[model samples]
Target: MALKQIWEETNMKIIVKDLSPVLLQTKNVFEVADQKLFRYGHLVLPCLSQNYGPTYFCKLEKIN
Candidate 1:
């Protein structure tokens, strides 16, 4: 909200250096922001994630 207030109509991006699938699969994990992104954005997994061990790096492109 604060960010949007400062920079309206700008593209927003979230960079996750380390995201574990295991953590996301947990029953207690529910992030509102992540949920919104998953619902309104397209998930993109790069080839580098395949070789980077258990964690992954991904991007989300908004649906507009």
Candidate 2:
């Protein structure tokens, strides 16, 4: 349900170096941001990294 909604809204292409599947699974657990507050033409990734607590890594493209 959430995935469908995400696909419908915007493109989600991110790169998490050295990130395991466990981290990937954890990454998806994000509450949708308020559109009014957030800027347009953007993709937000709410993540929990070992160094960062509840961080956001916004990506607009897929890089190698």
Evaluated with lDDT, which candidate comes out highest?
2
The residue ranges of model 1 lying beyond 4 angstroms of the native Cα positions read 9-25, 28-64
In model 2, what are the clashing residue pairs, if there are any?
A: none
Each model's lDDT comes to 0.38, 0.42
Question: What lDDT tens digits, residue by residue, belong to model 1 across residues 1-64?
Answer: 4434424666665333334454466424332134334432323332353442222224344333
lDDT of 1: 0.38
Candidate 2 whole-model C-alpha lDDT, 0 to 1: 0.42
Q: Report the C-alpha lDDT of model 2 over 11-59, residue by residue, as the tens digit.
A: 7744434323334464455433343454432234344553333334333
What is the clash count for each candidate, in the order shown? 0, 0
- What lDDT score goes with residue 2 in model 1? 41
TM-score, one value per model? 0.19, 0.22
Worst 10 residues of 1 by lDDT: 52-61
Name the runs in model 2 displaced over 4 angstroms: 1-28, 40-53, 62-64
- The alpha-carbon deviation from the true structure for residue 17 of candidate 1, after best TM-score superposition, in angstroms, is 8.9
